[model samples]
Target: MRDLNVCIIAFSSTSQSVNLYKILKNKKYNVVMIQTPCTISAGCARSIELKEKDLDAVVNEIKQNNLEIKGIYRRVLNDSTRRYYYSEIDI
Candidate 1:
């Protein structure tokens, strides 16, 4: 499968984002998450990225766990700007 560089999993609130961030971090998904960037604003206070494959399972778990998800955005960064791609899975 093609590799996915950055995946943004956004939550509905800082508290929610924190909790999800902790859970995902502990699970160790080769992706980095940071506080919500100025470019995007929503119920989420932060965003996370994991391998494309991990997206489905993570989202499922988040749903089962009752974690609020604002949205899941897929992005590809090149020379200067970032491009957005819609995804049902993580990548």
Candidate 2:
């Protein structure tokens, strides 16, 4: 099995999602902007993906920058089922 790295940032609005994406992207992380996955919902229609190792910094940026975050979720994709397990983060 292979491991996938991602961070699902649930924002209060699409605009906020875009802002978050910009901030993360500027940090030069492997970021991908996408809609909230079908199987998960933290109240955001948009999300950004980054390396798992960068999760802490990203979370810190959001908090430090006072970004409005609905929630942040981590996931381990079930390769066989091609689905993600939504889980919370302590940060």
Q: Best TM-score goes to which candidate?
A: 2
TM-score per prediction, in order, is: 0.67, 0.78
Write model 2 residue lDDT over 1-78, tens digit each, in one string. 235566676677888778878887787777888878766674667877777788888878888888887777777777
Off by over 4 Å in 1: 1-5, 78-91
lDDT of 1 by residue, 2-87 (tens): 22555677766778777777777777756577765545564456777666677777887687778887777665544343544434
Q: For model 2, what is the alpha-carbon lDDT of residue 42?
A: 47
Query: Relative to the unseen true structure, what is the Cα RMSD of model 2?
Result: 2.3
Question: Evaluated with lDDT, which candidate comes out highest?
Answer: 2
Worst 10 residues of 1 by lDDT: 82-91
